[model samples]
Target: MIAVWKEWAGEKLNESEWLSLLDLAQRESAEEDALVRGDLPVPPPPVSGHPRVTPPPPAPRHKVPDTPPPRPSTELDDRFGPWLARQLRRSGLTQSDLAMELGLTRAAVSAWVTGRAEPRSEVRRQVAKVLGGVQQFAPLERWKTGAAVLIGVSEYTHLPSVPSIKNNLSALTEVALTGLGIPHSNVHTVENPTSAAQVHEKIDLAMEAADPVSGGLFIYYAGHGWTDPRNGRLLLGLVESNQHKTWTAMEFDRLREQIADSPVGSRLLVLDSCYSGAALDTLSAGLSSASRIEGTYVMTSSNATNASRAPQGDHFTTFSGEIIRSLTDGIQGGPRVIDTDTLFRHVRASCEEQGWPVPSRQIGRDGDRVELMSNRWGQP
Candidate 1:
């Protein structure tokens, strides 16, 4: 049998390759035969004095030194600082005056304005509030008025099991989140999570840590979302074992519960997966305004029947790319404000121009209209 197998295997390779293949096959056959009879083989322990096979010493069990965590990588100081500086100058206040109002040292204010240092979250909010009141400083409108939470997930365990349409979806979300001023501290990217329970914990922690009084919360997911084979229930893929696993879309209902119980002004959920529209339906129904303050807006990459495609280059996923563009160009502060309807229109047009399918959504119970102030939208 061995001779016959080798002769056949040799037909596809050269002499040296055939020899190499034969050796590998023999080793595999020996291992297989050993396992079939339930034979257990034990190897000798490592020799302590052999230079080539020295025994390793037991590892020390000690507590690792607690180090201060690295600063979050929002990098907002570089891009937003000059713009803020200009706004401050136009406010007719010197750094000293601004510092006095913000209760900071002159040097600290100068550092923030000159990009020498980044301001803390509270300082950023104070600056926005001050500029928000000035009509001349209206260009910084969104920065001044609204606060937001951005969430993104990227790494997956089973690459093949990942959704075919959203390969670059996480990257797209990252770019959009960073560009739109969502602090890195708020961005959560899970890598190769192993269980549904882990997914729940990470998401719960992020949502719980979010600010309740800002503009809204944004959640972005990019991975394989599955429907339970048994019940046809939607599931968000999570890491489990050596393969892909899933969490029910219904799990997000807990987020709505938190929002319902909190004083958050508004909420927005962005999903990039199949049947994402359906997920929104489930989520919206779970959330009620009975105890909440504002409405929830749900945007999906595609309709329930469609799939969202990966982004084109360094750009965001089609829907998210357009949304970020709209935010950057249409909401950059000006007299003309871009309302939610207009923002969606822009997103639709941009997607249409790119020949990608348009995103669909169901806006639920929003009492106050969401708008972005943009000079490009024209006087409104």
Candidate 2:
């Protein structure tokens, strides 16, 4: 079998070709052994240039029983129905009263509850206004204790085509974090690690060393991110003897869980790589507390629809460079005071001004908005 595989490895065999060879070899070997034992007759080899025989006709297809029609696809009546329902219950608002207040029909409210229809955009806006008006809906708050850990892994031991642009991104992140008053002690960089295990171990160490007394924990990663087609899990590339073997994004989520389970306030994760947006949803599922108070805040360099790219003239990517600039703005006192929204706006503006592709940002909290803390003056 080993010899056969080696011989066939040099040839370009399709699936059928390989299967045919295997079948023929197996049958020949079995018949040879049978004849040796005088237990069966052995067939002679076919003559050269013999005509090929045609295969017998296939059996006729039988009609399949009709399957029952699938149930009608159901959609939530309120576009924000699911989210609104949760918010209403949290705020102690009854469906009827809430519907009346929002000028929505009672039946529409019922459909929302039953998820038979979705709220229109206008309705969602009104609902948001109500929630905001009463302070029933709030953004997530920054952690009061614990430091964030940002890790950037770049460079590859094998695949040279895999760019080393992450080095620039790491530099920008480091500078930004530093400008933001995130201590150097709280930041880590992993470059061209020999194996995925080493990268995972390093992340574990960083998470372990985090200071829970600081308020919030932040983790950032910039590298080659890949997804496993079979499992739909995200993966981070590392320097490996075999390029195929790399650390999975699931491992990072595990690391996040370790930090979140601790007494630390909250965890924030920032990933700058291809397909990072998917990681947000995947990681959110694994967190024990999906709320803003318990789980981590996730920000990706790009939306699931886009790919992140390295900057052309600079070592950093456009997003990383803009974030750094925001942190360094008015840096006489360290990172400028900026809110999360403001920071993102600055990033967006910079990208636009430079004609660089802008990456989308999404924020998911348990039930509140997330507040980013920085000495840099401005909103996030």
State which candidate has the highest TM-score: 1
241, model 2: CA deviation in Å? Answer: 7.7
The TM-scores of all predictions, comma-separated, are 0.50, 0.49
Worst 10 residues of 1 by lDDT: 56-65
Q: What TM-score does structure 1 among the candidates reach?
A: 0.50
In model 1, pairs of residues that clash are: 139-333, 147-215, 193-239, 194-239, 194-240
Candidate 2: Cα lDDT at 188: 55
In candidate 1, what are the lDDT values of residues 131-217, reduced to their tens digit?
433432233333233333333334444434433223344554444343333445655555545555554565565555555554444
| Candidate 1, position 282, lDDT | 59
